[model samples]
Target: MSSTCYLSLDWPTAPAWVNYNSLQQLSYFTTVFLAAPLALLTGLGMSPALSTRFRRISKLVSIQAARSLHFLVLVWFLVFLVVHVALVFTTDLQSNLNQMYAARGGDGWTGLWVFLASMAVVIGGWIAATPFTLRRLRALPHHEQITQHFCIQGWSGVTKWGGVSMRTILDLVKPRPEAKWVVFYSLGDGPDKWRYYDAHPIEQMSHRLTMLAYDMNGRPLSFGHGAPLRLRNEVQLGFKQVKWIEGIEFVADFSRIGGGHGGYNQDHEFFGYHQAL
Candidate 1:
């Protein structure tokens, strides 16, 4: 008599472990193990029973030192995040996502749903980071005055525009019924070079006009790089719109500032204000 048995086995090679540099591996391990455990220990250190032992440890690595180490690790994590993002863009993003999902042995329907969910998280996170969304959430509070320089304004060519939501900014200002004008004052480093456009009435202005917080390439605008806010007015030429705004005010006339020419536009400059398409 003879007996026959069949067996199936999966090996680690089936998953093909990706190689990581020492720093990369250490970063991943610390995030997964040491960091979490340290946090738990920090919390436990507050407990009365563990007070003696905790104090002993604390004396060895004093409280201030521990805090500094924790902060340093946090900064390290941020650096890791940058490297991770670079790798994601460098590699095939879809393939990586697919491989991760495939490891779960999910049915077709489940895999599809997971893919959709993952996409949603990425898109949702991007949207949440946008200036428009962030402003709505009060992440960038409307200040009475800010001295942002005009870093970049959209041009017909070779010009950059920060993605600023003009509609929301107008709403924040809430100009009076009698005040029909929107006056933008350039109060930054280049106040002398300030240009202004005879913008349309807030109500009449189309949504196309907005304060950009990001560039056309989807990159965030930094403070010095003309970020946090930008104005776009269809009624005025692109250059007339200011970037890195310092102050926004509602006034009856642009001439109130000086030289009855309304603004730099009224006084012919190199970039004359014209209605943009």
Candidate 2:
């Protein structure tokens, strides 16, 4: 295989190896090693003959093996595509390659260094965000509490909640000095498309008994009882403790929020926004 490339500034003679140079070698690698192999394996897997008499070919070329190879080829090529694109766009991409991209161009290391720094920041963020938080919320300090939930309907129940303390979340977000309240928005909505959200004091948020629960009675919360996440404020009525929480926002006040009231049900159903058990 022979090929040619402009890796260096010098335009070498022949640019060939065994009748090829940098470019020829590159073409050979792409066609023979990457594209051609994938195409050949794909064609082989798609043929109906593989499941017939060919199934007993030394156990290496069985129907299962063929299909596995085909699937692996797809995953392999996808990874290759992502890596090559990242290297090109993040490191050495140049609109005018004829005058740039060489080490002698005086900017060869700049893009690579910047790319490394960016990757470091991104990796740091991924680690900090995913391992301790994100959709996986169990990594925070767990606080279990048995409390009574009082509803305006005069019904009540004592339940055990397993969740992270609100203080942990407060430390993570570090709300601004002006942020007096945090609003919890629910996935549920009222008629006329009124979004269901409620505000609570920031001080109550940091209270030891307040939490965002994902487990009830030592089991993962079920959909009937607010799966994934739900607010737990032992000091407040049930409505004030939002369920099926979708998002949260920090604000200075709630008077300018929906219906000039502090919550959705309060706005629509005339319920008290700030009620206690």
Candidate 3:
């Protein structure tokens, strides 16, 4: 793919350049002298062993100028190659067509059409190459968000979070029609000997921003934040973001869960079970 990309950069060369006029003194000098030095410059420029010396050289010659010259050499080589290939094809169309088309004896137009079709496929592939390999922000069933968090404790702050969307989890679990809530359990226990836990409605769980976060501000969640994992339901208050989460239980209702409340705070402090904004 890299080779094809390098070659295709010079694909728009005019057909008329295939004639004897292109092999002038300048072209000959470039093919012999410039080609060898350009090759050496590219090698030394990329070499870790030579990097310090190369930097000193770069101060005098400028690495950008060397790179430009190397690229020009590549372009010249590609154009020269194309010209020779075109010359071969055009010099004896019938014979070359026979050789190219598996020695299948036929009219010259048949081989010409075949060549044109191959060129179309090559050009189309070149155009689509970048998009096929390009990736954005290293995401795979992941999202990054910067939002504010406010809790009943009167604490408020903003943070950037990175995690997998709850919607992705829903697609994997495929909850039954009766499962109305998702209960998240934490490894941390409260003073009352109950584990810190919370519940979210099935609809809220499917929200795009509702996620299981393992990253905070481009790094793994710190202990002060939630190490390992935490829940992030954007539409709700910060208390619902269960920290040090251990397990998840899908249920029809939260009545059977701890303290018959939807969350640890709701059970202990009489806070409302649902707080959405």
Candidate 4:
């Protein structure tokens, strides 16, 4: 199938069993050759090691772009599978089953049983998967309450956030003098999804309002609101305030990090690098 797509072979018109137009042939060719390779390349762009090692390519195909393209590829595959199966069943169910499972030209129950079992496994796995798990907060050296939540979409909320200041953690870590940026990584959509993260200039971390918040509204944060820890950067828009924070790193430059465009939203959504508004 892949070889035929790569060679750009002409669609077969003489076969009586195979009934497809030029449009269908073009769609199949595009899905196999173009979408499949693009999906693979975008998936590779999301890898932390690969993105760092191949900085230029990573920048060109930002992590968020890779995620979006990957989703589109999945949609295409699902559409193709549905159409292909419908066509086979409508045309000749017995012959199709025999060719696929029995590997012969005779009708038999062997193929039907095999298909049923494969579907059962897939459905069982889907049912077994669950949602996010709760994470607990650990002891911190200092905690303070601040009321400043700047939303980027023209609304703002003033909630008291309780947690340790970024400066205090920096003091403990003792980052190198040359470090000019701070990167915060957080949990996203699901366990299978890529980690959500953002980068801020080192100067922004010095602001008194910046901290790793663990409590909101005088209560421990719920899992939906980023339990354990979340970044609170008063100077930037709310999106830059990464939630469900897992780790923090001090780096001299962000060019080697994911997408190399200052932050995830900036790289993918074309948001301003310094969103003070």
Candidate with top lDDT is 4
Predicted model with the maximum TM-score? 2
Q: Which ranges in model 2 have alpha carbons more than 4 Å from their true place?
A: 1-117, 125-136
Q: Per-residue alpha-carbon lDDT of model 1 for 81-170, expressed as tens digits?
A: 886655543454444545566554322344446667988999999977654344552354322212223333532443444444566566
lDDT (10s digit) by residue, model 2, range 1-277: 2212334323333222125546546745875688767768665644432222143341355434555777777676676677545434544354212123333344346555655677799899988776333355787778899988767788879899998888889998899999998888766555543456788888899788999999999999988787778999777767777887767778888776666577777777775556444
Give candidates' CA RMSD values in order.
Answer: 18.3, 16.1, 18.4, 11.7
lDDT of each: 0.49, 0.67, 0.68, 0.72
Stretches > 4 Å off in candidate 1: 1-164, 189-206, 222-225, 268-277
Cα-based TM-score, every candidate: 0.36, 0.57, 0.48, 0.50
Quote the positional error of residue 263 for candidate 3 in Å. 1.6
Give per-residue lDDT, candidate 1, residue 6.
Answer: 9
Expressed as tens digits, the lDDT of each residue in 87-112 for candidate 4 is: 56765676677677667655676776
TM-score of 3: 0.48
How many clashing residue pairs are found in candidate 1? 12
Q: For model 3, how does the per-residue alpha-carbon lDDT over 1-277 read when each residue is reduced to its tens digit?
A: 2345334554323333334343345666776788767777775553322322233553455434555767777787888778657655555666556557545654556776777788899999888663311122135467778888876688888989987777777876789999998888776656654456788888998777788888899998887687787889988877678887756778888775666778778888975667577
Residue pairs with backbone atoms closer than 3 Å in model 4 (clashes):
none
